[model samples]
Target: MSQNTFDGVRTAIIANKVDGIVREMTNTLLRSARSAVINSARDFSCAILTDDDQLLTAAEGIPVHVFGAQLQAQALRAAHPDMREGDAYLDNNPYVGNSHAADHTILVPVFVDGEHLFTAVTKAHQADVGNSIPTTYHAAAKDVYEEGAVIFPTVKVQTNYENVDDVIRMCRTRIRVPSQWYGDFLAELGAARVAERRLKELVAKYGVETIRQFVTDWLDYSETVMAKAIESLPAATLRNTGRHDAFDPFLPDGLDFGVRIDIKPDQGRIDVDLTENGPNVDCGLNLTEATTRAAVFGGVFNAIPARVPKNSGAFRRVVVEMNEGSAVGKPKFPHSCSVATTNVTDRLINCVGAAFAQLGEPYGVAEGAVGVGAGYAVLSGRDRRTDEDFVNQLCITANGGPGSAYADGWVTYGVPCVSGLMYRDSVEIDEIKMPIRYKHLRMVPDTSGAGKYRGAPSFEFAYTPTADPISVIYPCDGQIAPSKGVAGGEDGARAAAWLEDADGTRSQLPNTVAMVLQSGQTVHGFDASGGGYGPPLQRDPRLVLEDVLEGWETAEHATATYGVEFIDTPDGLAVDDAATERRRS
Candidate 1:
C-alpha cells in the first residue's frame, strides 16, 4: 500500500467494521450478564482503544462510561509495563482514572505477530459494591474508608488466558451475592475477549500494513469532521453557575457550582475550565478525575451535532482544565467519590449544557431532571421465594429529559449522566425476580415545564414488599431547585420519596434515603420533570389540543399555560380557535 493512497470508501468500511465490533461486545455483555443492572437496565459500555492507549471507538456506548476510557488504559500501561499476549486488567480506582468504584472495568490488550495493536474494554456499574449500605451510591460516606468498597487500581485479574483465582476469590468474599457477581464478571470478561478475537480476524482479512494505515487516516479524518462541526458554531466565552440542594450538617446552604466554556470557532477548539470551584468536602459528592472530564465532554457533545465521533481523534480539539482539590474539578485524596457517577455530576451537566444558552436562540438545552430517583432504587434482602440472598438496582421509572430546540424531552430518560441510553426495565421482570409488587405507576400531570417544546412530565411509582422486609436506598437529587427552563419557559416540579406504613403512618424521606419497608408498607416516589425549551405562549394550538385530548393536561390547564381554549362538541372536545385567539390577545 502506497503512503499517498487515501481511500475514503475503504476508510468508511473499516470504520463501520470497528464500530460493529464494539456494538457486538455490548450486545454480548447485556445478553449474558446475570445482574439486572446489566441485562435489564443496560448500565454498561464497550470500546476499542489504540495501541498507544487512545480511544479508537466506542460506538453507542454511554457518554459518561466511554468518554474517559483512554485515561484508564493509560493507567493500566503505567502499572504493568511488561505487557503480554494473554492478560486482562481490572480498574475501579477513582484517583487512578475511573468514574467511581462501582464501575468495574475489564481491559484486554490485543496483539498480533509480536506487536501490540489494540485493547478491548468493557465497563459496568455493579449492583452491589460492598458498601456500608446496600446501595452503591453512598451519598453520605465521609471518606473512602467510610465508603467501604474494594478499589482496584489497574490491577491484573487474568493472565495467560486464565482467571487469577486469588482476585476472583477476594471479590467473591467481599461482594454480596458472590455467585451473581462472579457470573456478571465472567460475562463482562467474555465480552472483551470476543472483541479481541474479532480484531485478530480483521488483521487476518486485511494485512497489518493496511490496517495500521487505516487507523492513522481514519483518526485524521475524524479530526477534520469535528473541526468542521465547531467551525459551524459561533465563537463564545460563556460562564454559568448553579447550586446543589443542601445536605444537612455538611453543606447547609448547599454546594454552589460554576463552569466556563470558551469556543474558538475559527480554530475549531473549545476549552472547559473548572479551576474556579469550591474545595472538596467530606461527603461522597466530590468528583473523581474521570467524572469531571466525562461530565464536561457529555455536556459539550450534547451541545454540538451528534454526528461528531466521540473518540480520542475528535477529543484532541477540546481542552478540559480541572483543579486537583476542588469538589467538582477532581478528586481530593481519600475523599469519598462513592456517588461520583451521579448526584453533583448531573447538576454540572445541566449547568454546562444550559451555559450554551448565552449564545442565544436554538443554541442551548433546558435543564433536565437530575438524580437516580426512588424508581431506580437499590433493593436487597433474602428472596423468600427462592431462599437465596438477592440484590439489584432496579431501573423502573427514569428521570425526565430536558426539552431541546428541536424536540420534546424523552419520557424514559434515566438521567443526564446516562444520556438516556440506559433502558427502563420492564415491570413484569421485577415481579418475577424480586418479592415485590407494583401498585400504580402513572405520569404526573401539570408537572411538565410548559413551552413551545414542552419538557417531559414527572412520573410517580408505588410499590410494596410482598414476602419479606426489604432494604430500599436511593441517592436522589433535584428536590430544592427543580429543573429550570431556559428561553422564557416555566420551571418544572420538585421530586419526593416517602413511605406509608401498615398503620397509615407517613414519613417524608430525605434526598439520600435508606430505610426498610415492611411487608405491608409501601414506597411512593415522584421524579422531577425536565425544563421546557421556549416560551409557552409560542406553542401551537393543535399540539395543545392534542395534549388535552390525551389527558396530559386538562382543558383549563391548556388555557392557562398555553392560551388554548377547548369546547365540548357533539362528537368530542375541540379547540375553540376563536376563543383561543381572543384570549391570547
Candidate 2:
C-alpha cells in the first residue's frame, strides 16, 4: 500500500465502515458489562490499532486509556510472536504499557485469512482489581507490593476462542468478587471478539489490499490536517508550572510540575519538555509510562482545533521529552502507579492547556477542576438483597469545566481525563444495586469562577449506607490549589468533604480518605468549580442576570463578583442598566 493511490470517496467510506465496527465493540461492552461502574457509569473504552503501531479510534476513545495505545500494542506483539486468530491477551501491568492495574484490558488480534491486520482493544475499569485495600487508587501504597493488585504482563488468556482455565482459576482465587470479575472479563472479551468479527467482515467486503490502502491514506490525511493546523499558529515558546496539594505528613510542601513548550510553526511540531518536573515519590500518585505519554498529548490535542484527527499521524506532530524516573515521566518498576489515570496526570494536562493560553485569545481554556473527590469515591460493602459483597466507584458528581473563549464552562464536565465522556450513574441504580441511599445532589450558588464567560458552578452530593457499615476510599485533591483562571479570569472554590452524624453533628474530613461509613452517618462532598476565562466586568449583564435567576449565582454575587446589578421584576431578576454601569465603573 502506497500514498495518494486510493480515492478520497473510497477512503472515507472504508474509514466509516471500520469506525462503525469500533462502535459495535463499544456497544457490546457497554451492554454486556456487569459492574455498575461499567454498565451504568460507562467506565470503559474500545479502540482498534494497526499492527504497525498506529491507533485508530475515529472519535471513540478515552484520553487516558487510548493515548499510548501503541505502547500496549508493541508489548503485546513483542511478547507473543505466535499470535493468531481466535487468541486473546490481557495486560494490566502499569510497569508495562497499561495506564494502571485497575484497568483490565483485553487484546484480540484481528486476522484476515492468516495475516494479522488489526488488534481490537477493550479496556474497562473493574469494580475490584484484587488490591490490598479494596479500593483501586491506593495513594498510600508505598510501592507495587503494597498496592497488591495482581500484575498481568501481556499474558495469553485465550487460544482458539477457548478460555485458559488455569488463568481463570488464578483470577477467581485472588480477586474479591469472583463472579463479578468473571462477568466483566467476559464482557471485555465479548467486545474484542465482536470487533474481530466486524473487522474481518469489513476486510472481506473491501479486500485486504484495499483496507491496507485505506489505513495508509487515512493516516496521511490526518497528518496533513494536523500539519496545516500547526502551521496556522504563530510560533511561540511558553513555560508554565502546575502544583498538586501536599500529601500532609509525607509531602508537606507539595509537588511542583514545570512544563516548557516550543511551538515550531515552520516544522509543524510542538515540542513538550517534561524533564524539569519533580522526581517520583514513594506514593501511588507516580505516573506509569502509558499515562505520562497520554497526559501530555491529550492536552496538546485539546488546545488545538477539534477537526484535527487524533491518530498516530497527528501524534507525530508533537515531540515529547521525558526524563527517566521523573514524577511525570517514566517510572521505575515497583513504583505504585495505582492512581496513575488521574491525580498528577490531571494537573499535567491542565498545565499544558494553561500554557497554550500564552498564545493569546481563543487559543486555550483556563485550568479546569482537578482530582477525584468523595462524589467519585470507591465504596465497598455487603449487599443485603443479594447477601454478597460489593465494591464499586460512584460517578454521580464531577468537577466543573473551565471557561472557554466562546462559551461558559459545561456544568456536567467531568474530570479533565474523562472530558465529559463518562455517564452519570442513575441514583435508582445505586440504591437498587448496593445498600445505599442518596440524600441530594445539586449545584451550589456563587461557586463558579466569574468572567466574561463564567466557569461552571460547584456541585455537592450526599449519601448514606443502609447496611451496618461500608468502606469508602477516595484520593481527593484540589483543596489548597483551586482551578486557576486564565486571560484575567477568577479562580473557582476549593473542594470540601464532611461526615454528618445521626445527631446532625458534622466533622470535616481530609482530602485523602480511607474510612468506613456507619449506617446512620451521611457523607457530603462539594467539588470545586472550574476557572473563568475573561474579566467578569466584561461579562454580559444578561448572562449574569440569567445566572441569578437560575440560582447558580446570587444577586449579591452578581453585583460583587460580576459587577452586574439585578432588579427584581414580576417575571424574574432583570439586569439594572444604571446600577450595573455604576458597579462596573
Candidate 3:
C-alpha cells in the first residue's frame, strides 16, 4: 500500500486493467441482452467503483451513464448501508441518482475474503419499465406517478446471489413484454457478475492493498492531467442562454435555460451557475440534481483534451450550482423525470458549450441539436410471425449530429450525453423483429446546417404497419427550438412527424402524443439537422461541389448558401471557379 511501490508505468497498466474489467462487463451484457435497444443499439454503460463509491474506471459508452455511475453507486450504498457480499441492488429513480427512470442500474458488491473492496455497476436503458406506455421516453406523462415505470430506488433486487421473488414477480406482471424485460434484467445482472469476477481476479493477482494503492495513484494522475488542462484554458467568466422546446403542457412557450461559467485557471476551477434557469413543470422533462451534475461534467470533459481520464479526479476542478426548484437541478418528489435525461440534459450541455465557445475555447463545438432521440417514436404490437408481443423505441442513431468548429458533424452522432458510438438498428432487423416494414429510408436533401463546415445532414423515412393495428407513441424534440450554429453558422432544419392513413388522409402527430397505426397506414418523419459552423461563404468551393455531386445539396442550393458555382461536367459535377469568384466579389 506504499506510494513508492506504484510508479507511473505501473499505475498506467493498472488503470488499463481496471478499464478492461468494465469493457468485459459491457461485452457480457451486449452478448446476453435480448432487446435490440441493448444488443444492437448498445445503450448501456459499465463502471468499477471504490468501496466508498468513487469512480475508478469505466467503459466507453454513454457519457451521461458513465458519469452518473459513481452517483448511482453512492445512492445504492446510502440506501443499503448493510450491503454485503452477494448483495445486488436496482434503482432507476432520477431523484435517487440515476439519469432517468428508464436507465436502470445494477450494482454488485465485491468482497475479497472478509473485507469489502469494490463495487461493479452496470447501467442500461430498458425499453420498457412497467410504464403506462411502452417507451422509456414518456413525454406525455403529466406526473411521475403516471409516467408508467415503477421507480425502484436502491432496492435489494438480489441477496446471496439469488433473485428476489417479489421483485421478479412485480416486474413480470407489470411489464407488457415480460420475456424481453426479464432477459434484459438478467443481462444486466450478468454484466455486474462479470465485473465482480474480474475485480476479484485483479485482487488475487496483485494483492488487495497493492490494487487499492494503484487506484489511488491512478486517480491522482487523472487529477493532475485535468488540472494541467484547466490551467491552460483561457481565464474568463461567460454568461450564455439557450432554449429548449418543452413538451409539457404547462410550458407552452417553451423553457428558457441559462448558464454563467467562470473559468479560473489559476484556481483550477470552472464554476457554473444555473440559478437563472427555468423552474420545474408538469412533465417528464425535469432533471434531477445528479443528472444536472452529469450534464455539466459531460460538457467540461468533452471540451477538455482527451488525455484526461473521466474518473473522480477529472471532476475535482469543476463546481456547479443550481437552484433547488430549477428544471435542471433538484426536483421534488413525484416530479416526473422519465424523459429528463434527453433534451433537457442536452440543453444544459449546449449552454455550457456555447459559453466556452464565447470564451474562445478551441474545444467548444457549435450548439448541437443533440438528443434528436428525445422525439423518439415507440411502436408496439403483436407480431404475426411469432404471435408474440413486441415493443421498441427507435434508436437515436437514425438522426444526424450537430456541427463542430473543426469539422462537419458526423451523421447520426447518437445523443448529446453519449460518446457517439451507438449503432442504429438495421432495417432488416426491424422487419424481422417488429411488425413493420420500411417503405423508404434515406437522408433528406439540403437539410444540413449550411456553413463553411456544414453540420451533418438529417434523414427522412416512412414505414407501414404489417398488422391490422399497432400502437405508437411519439416523443420528439427540435421542432420549435432547433440546433443553432456558432459564430456565423446557420440553424439546422426542424423535425417533422405525421401519419398517412389508408384513405390518403394525413394527420400530424404532436411532439408528445400517442396514437394507433392501422393496416395500410404509413408513418413518415423528417429528422432535424445539425447547426452549421462559421459562414457559408467561407466554405471551400470544391467541398460545395462535392456536396452537390453527392446529392446532399442541389446546385442552386449550393450557390445560394455557399456562394459557390457548380457546373455539369463529364465527370459528374465541377466547381466553376470563374462564376464562383464573381459571386464572391
For 1-585, candidate 1 gives per-residue lDDT tens digits of 234788889999999999999999999999999998899889999999999988889998987888889999999999998888899998899887889999999999999987889999999999988888888888788999899999989889999999999998999999998898999899999999999999999999998998998888788777888888888889989999878888776566788989999999899888989989988988888988888888888888766754877888888888999899889987877999988888788888888888886676777888888867788889999898899988999888867788777787887777889978998887888888888999999888778888888888889998999979999988888888888788877777788988888898888878877888889999988988888888898888998888777767778788999999888899898888899999888
Instruction: For model 3, state the Cα shift of residue 455 in Å.
Output: 1.0
Please report how far candidate 2 places residue 403 from its true position, in Å.
Answer: 0.7
- Model 1 TM: 0.97
Tens-place lDDT per residue, model 2, 1-585, is 245475889988887887888788889888988889999998888889997867876356778888887788899988998898889999998977899999999999888879989999999998888899989989888889999999898999999999988888999999888888899999999999989888888888889898888888888888888888888888999999988898766556777888999999899888999998777788889888889888888788767655887778888888899977877988887788999999899888888987887787778788788869898889998887888998888988978888877888888878888777888899998888778999999989999988888889899999999866999999888988999898899988888999999899999988789999998999999998899988989999988888887898888878899888777789866888998899789
Q: How accurate is candidate 1 locally (lDDT)?
A: 0.87
Residue 525 of model 2, lDDT score: 93
lDDT of each: 0.87, 0.86, 0.79
TM-score for candidate 3, please give it: 0.95
Best by TM-score: 2
Give the alpha carbon lDDT tens digit for every residue of 1-585 in model 3.
Answer: 245665888787888888888889989998999888888778888888888788888758677787767888878878888888898998887876788888888889999996888988888888788788777787667688898788888889999999998988898898889999899999999999988888898899999878878878877888778888889888888888877776657567777878888888898778988887777877777888777988888877755545788888777778888887667888877778877777788877766775666654255666665544322567788888898888977663456666666678787775566636677777787677788888887887788988778888887788888865888786677778888877678988877777898898998766666778889988888787777777889888988887887888988888888999877789867888999999988
| RMSD over all Cα atoms, model 2 | 1.5
Off by over 4 Å in 3: 1-6, 246-250, 370-375, 567-572
Q: After superposition, which runs of candidate 2 have C-alpha atoms over 4 Å from their true positions?
A: 1-6, 569-571
Sorted on lDDT, highest at the top, how do the candidates line up?
1, 2, 3
